[model samples]
Target: MSGTLRFLLASWKVNLASALEYRLSFFLLAGMMFVNNTIWLFFWYLFFARFPVVSGWEIGDVMLLWAVSAGGFGWASVLFGNFPRIATIVSSGQLDVYLSQPKPVLLNMLTSRMSVTGAGDFAFGLIVFLWAGDLTPRGCLLFACALLLAGVLFIGVMAIAGSLAFWIGNAEGIASQVFGGFISLTIYPTGIFRGAAKVILFTVVPAGFIGYMPIGLMREFDPGFAAAAFCAAAIFSACGALLFRVGLARYASGNAMTMRN
Candidate 1:
C-alpha cells in the first residue's frame, strides 16, 4: 500500500513538473478555464438577480454546486489527468507502454499527465466555497467530502465511457459526448430536473448524486443520500475497472511509437 502510494505521488510530481515546464502556457490555460467558469457563475448571478430562486435554490447553493462540480473535476484532472483521454490512449495503442510497466496500467496511465486548466478550476472552487459555503468545521468537512465524491464520480464515469474503445475500436466521440453531458448535468439544480430526466440523472448517468450534494449533503446532511453517493462512486469505479480489464483482451495495437521520460 505504501509503495503504491509512493508511486502515485511520484507520478503526480513528475506530471506537475512537466506541466510547469512551460510556465506561461500553464498559467494561461489555468487562468482561462478559471475565467470561463467565472463567466458561467456570472450568468447564474444574473439569473438569480432576476428570479432570486429557482426550484428552491438560491445563489449560494448554485455557487456551491459549481464549486463541487468544477473543483471535483479539477482535482481529478490534475491528479488522474488521463481519465478523459482513456479512449484515445487505448485506440492509439498507448497502453502498450503501461502494460509493460510494473505498475498498474490504469493508475499509471491515468496519472501520467496533469491538466493545467484543472488547477484553475480547483482554485475557483475554493474561492467559491469561501464566498458561499459554510465556514464551520462540520460544513467544511462535508464540503470536502462532496468534492471527493464528485471527483470519483467523474473519473469513474469517464473511465467507463473511455473503455468503450476496447469493444467498439474507437469511442472517442461517444466519450466526449458523455463527458460534456455529465458536466452539463452536474452544474444544474437537481430540483429543476423532473420525472424521466431526474430518473436518468440519478440512475443512468448518475449526475444527481453530484448535483444534489450541495443541498443533500451540505445543507441537510441526509445520511441516505450520502451513503448512496458513496456507493454510486464505488460502483462506477468498480465497473470501469472491470470493463477496462475485460476490454484489454481485445485491444489492438496501433503500432505507434511511444515513450515516457
Candidate 2:
C-alpha cells in the first residue's frame, strides 16, 4: 500500500511538472471554467429575479444545489479527468502499458492527468454555497457529508461510463452526453420530476442521488436517507470497479512495437 502511494505521488509530481510546462494554457483553462460556471449562476439569478422563486425553491436554495453539484463535479474532474478519455487510451492500445504495471490500472488511469482548471470551479461553487446562506452547526456537518458522498457517486458514475469504451470502442460522445444529461437534471429542483422519472434517476441513472437526495437530507435531516445515499454510493463504486476489471480482461494491444511502461 505504501509503495502504491509512493508511486501515485511520483506520478502526480510528473503530471504537475507537465502541466507547469504549459502554464499559460493552464491559466486560460481555469479562467474559462470560472466564466462558464459564473454564466450558469447568472442564468439562475436571472430566472429568480424574474419570478422570485421556482416551485417554492428560492434563489438561495438553487444556489445551494449548484454549489453541491458543481463542487462535487469539479472535484471529480480534477480526480478523474482521464475517465472520459479512457476510450481513446483503450482504442489506441495505450491501456496495454497500464495493464503491465505493478500498481492498479484504475489508479494509474486516475493519476495520469490532473486538471487544475477544476480548482476554479470548486472554489467558485464553494464561495457561492457559503455566501448563499448561514447554516447551523448541524447543517454544516450534513452539507459536508453530502458533498463528499456526491463526489464519490459522481466519480463512480464516470468510471462506469468510461468502462463502456471497452465494449463500444468509441465512448467519448456517449459519456459526455450521459454526464451532460445528469448535470441538466441536477440544476433543477428534484420536485419538478415525476414518479417514473424520479425512479429512473434514483436507480438507473442515479442522478438524483448526486444532489436531490442529499439536499433532501439536508432540508429534513433524515438519517435514513443519508444512510441510503452512502450505501448507494458504495454500491455504484463497487459496480464500477467490477465493470472495469471485466473490461480489462478483454483489452488487446494494437501496437506491437511499443513496449509497456
Candidate 3:
C-alpha cells in the first residue's frame, strides 16, 4: 500500500512538472475555466436577485452547490484526470500500454494525465466558499467531506459509463453524454426536482447525492442522509471497480505503437 501511494505521488509530481513546462498555456487554460464558472454563477445571481429564492432555496445554497460540483469535479479531473475519458481510451486501445505495465491498470491510466483547467475549477470553489458559503468550522469540515464524496461519485459514474466501451465497441459518445448530463444535473437544487424525476436523480444518475450535499451535510446536518450518501459513494465505487474489472477481462490489445511519454 505504501509503495502504491508512493508511485501515485511520483506520477502526480511528474505530471505537474510537465504541465509547468508550458507555463503560458497552463495559466491561460485554467484562467478561462475559472471565468467560465463565474459566468454561470453570475446568471444564477441575477435570477436570485429578482426572485430571492427558488423553492425555498436562496443564493447561498446554490453557491455551496457550485462549490461541491466544481470543487469535486476539479479534484477528480486533476488527480484521476482520465476518469471521463475512459471510453475513448478503451475504444481506441489506449489501455494497451497501461495493461502492459506493472502497476494497477486503472490507477495507471487515471494518473497518466492531468487536466490544467481543473486547477481553475478548484480555485473557483474555494473563492466562492469564502465569498458566499457558511464560514463555520463545521461548515468547512463538511464541505471538504462533501468534496471527497462528490469527486469519488463523479469518477465512479463515469467509470461505469466508460466501461460500456467493452461491449458497445465505440461508446465514447454515450459516455460523454452521460458525463455531461450528470454535471448539468449537479448545479441545480435537488428540491427543484421531485417524484419520479427525483428518483431518477438518485438512481439513474445519482446526481441527487451530490446536489443534496449542501443542504443535507453542510447547511443542516442530517446524520441519516449523510450516512446514506457515504454508503452511496462506497456502492458506486465498488460498482465501477467491478465493471472495469469485467471490461478489462474482455479488453483486447492493439497493434498501435506506444510511448510512455
In candidate 2, where is summed lDDT lowest over 10 consecutive residues? 252-261
- Residue pairs with colliding backbones in model 3 are none
Encode model 2's per-residue lDDT on 41-105: one tens digit a residue: 89989988998866667777778888888787777666665665666676667777678788789
Cα-based lDDT for every prediction: 0.94, 0.75, 0.90
Candidate 1 colliding pairs: none
lDDT of 3 by residue, 105-215 (tens): 889999988888998998898898888887788778889999999999999999899999988879999999999999999999999998999999888789999999989
RMSD of 2: 2.7
The weakest ten consecutive residues by lDDT in model 3 span: 252-261
Off by over 4 Å in 1: 259-261
Top-scoring candidate (lDDT):
1
Q: How would you encode candidate 1's per-residue C-alpha lDDT over 171-222 as one tens digit per residue?
A: 9999999999999999999989999999899887999999999999999999
Q: Residue 18 of model 1: what lDDT? A: 94
lDDT of 2: 0.75
With candidate 1 superimposed using the best TM-score fit, by how many Å does residue 106's alpha carbon deviate from the native?
0.6
